[model samples]
Target: MVKDEYTLVLVKPDGVKTRHIGEIITRIERKGYKIEALKMIQPTEELLRQHYADKVDKPFFPELLEYMTEGPIVGIVVSGTNVIKAIHNMAGATNPVEAEWGTIRGDYGREWPDGNLRNIVHTSDEPSSATKEIKIWFPEFEFTQG
Candidate 1:
């Protein structure tokens, strides 16, 4: 049997509104990960507040909250070998201008009013983060033994 790893993925508001969901998922699947769980939901202020607690004190917090809650997004839990790093590479840098071609952000991101890249997707930066984020986004969706 093939051993697999897992990662958390977020098809951000822009990606969802732009109708890039299928393409993004296809890219991940083509990279060899399996979509273990997927859902579309509008995040609440409380959820965003907690999810981005690390950024709460930043000057961009308010706007970030506004942007995140503006529309529905797809939350996904994907699993495969070395999936965490693979997914991060697929997501690219937070700033689209700095991202290379073929990455999700590089292809679909836009410059925000604040001059930062409001990239169209998010992936956990590491395995620990993936575990934490997955739980936050999918509390009721349990991971079973493969």
Candidate 2:
């Protein structure tokens, strides 16, 4: 049997504000991932800081925080075989302009007027990130590894 893996998927503020949550969720489900838990939240700057600790000092950090906290985001625990990679692929490149067609970013994300990173979804890029993010996004939810 294929052991199931889990990923933390978040449809960012822009996605919700633009009403792309349904389409994004539909794509995840269509790809065979299971959403074990989900919630909408207006994330804190502190949480964003911790989440992007490595990039917190970068110039774009403030913009990232402001953008992320702009509105409510839908966070989901997505599970399946190789879900981390699958979700990232679906999210496309960090810059929507470089993303391929059919990807979530390519399909709906648009470049900011100033060329900022306005890609819609934020999916964990690795197992480590997934583990950390799952905790931050769903602290009370319990998860079991297969």
Candidate 3:
């Protein structure tokens, strides 16, 4: 039997900077996804490092860190059938310029002349990623093992 899935969605610093939090949440609710928990966080370097452990060594990590820490980010725990993949598709491409028109990134994202890529949102790519990210962003929530 298929179990309902839970995933993490983050309105990145750019999303908050551009004031798209309400619209983003509205889209999630409009899709009939349950928002289990939500919080606004001023991300720290340590938390970001742990959240992005795989990318810490990448050349763009520093820039990413700067961008993420520039302002507050909204973390949302969403639950529904196949929500991980569904929300991922809803978030659109990593680059706003490449995203589809109906997706969140394409609608609210903006390009910076300084070449900083400020994609508006982040969603876990898969179940495992959701598990880990939810722990990072919503540590107080307990997971029920299936």
Candidate 4:
């Protein structure tokens, strides 16, 4: 799994508003990864609809969509060895309350309006997901070596 790899990294609205963009990017780069593509965009309802479409029928879907569209987010494509799994480990659990101390979620998140945990980041959960998400968020951008 050491071959060239890429994963999507998002600096959620909270992260961006809190100025954690630089810190998050530093963490990834310090781990020997390269950022391939990046953008700051306010996602549309349709965009969020497609991105989390799988969770559309879930109980938390509405709130999640609203939260995502609340403000601008930094969407990025990062490349390196085992980047998908690496990013997931760095992001930690979905529930910040249960996330490990050193992970991004644990350090920056708190419970949200609906009593659900409001982690400040999102990482693709698998290789297939990474591919799908990167395409969804950065369709025009292509991965290249740094």
- Model 2: per-residue lDDT, tens digit, 7-122? 99899998999999999989999998898998998899888888899999899898888889989999999999988998998899988889999999998898877656788999
lDDT, each prediction: 0.86, 0.89, 0.93, 0.85
Worst 10 residues of 2 by lDDT: 110-119
What does the lDDT come to for candidate 2? 0.89
Error of 1 at 9 (Å): 0.8
> Which wins on TM-score, candidate 2 or candidate 4?
2
Cα error of candidate 3 at position 124, Å: 0.2
Task: In candidate 2, list every pair of residues with a backbone clash.
Answer: none
On TM-score, the candidate that comes out on top is: 3
TM-score of 3: 0.97
Candidate 4, residues 1-146: lDDT per residue as tens digits? Answer: 34778899888888888888998988999999988888998888888877897999999887888788778999988988888899899998888889898899888877767664457888988878888888889889775653
Among all windows of 10 consecutive residues in model 4, the one with the lowest summed lDDT is: 109-118
Q: What order do you get sorting by lDDT, best first?
A: 3, 2, 1, 4
| Superposition-based RMSD of candidate 2 using all C-alpha atoms, in angstroms | 1.1
True lDDT of residue 110, candidate 3: 69
How far out, in Å, is residue 17 in model 1?
A: 1.0
Query: After TM-score superposition, what is the CA distance of residue 81 in candidate 2 from its true location, in Å?
Result: 0.7
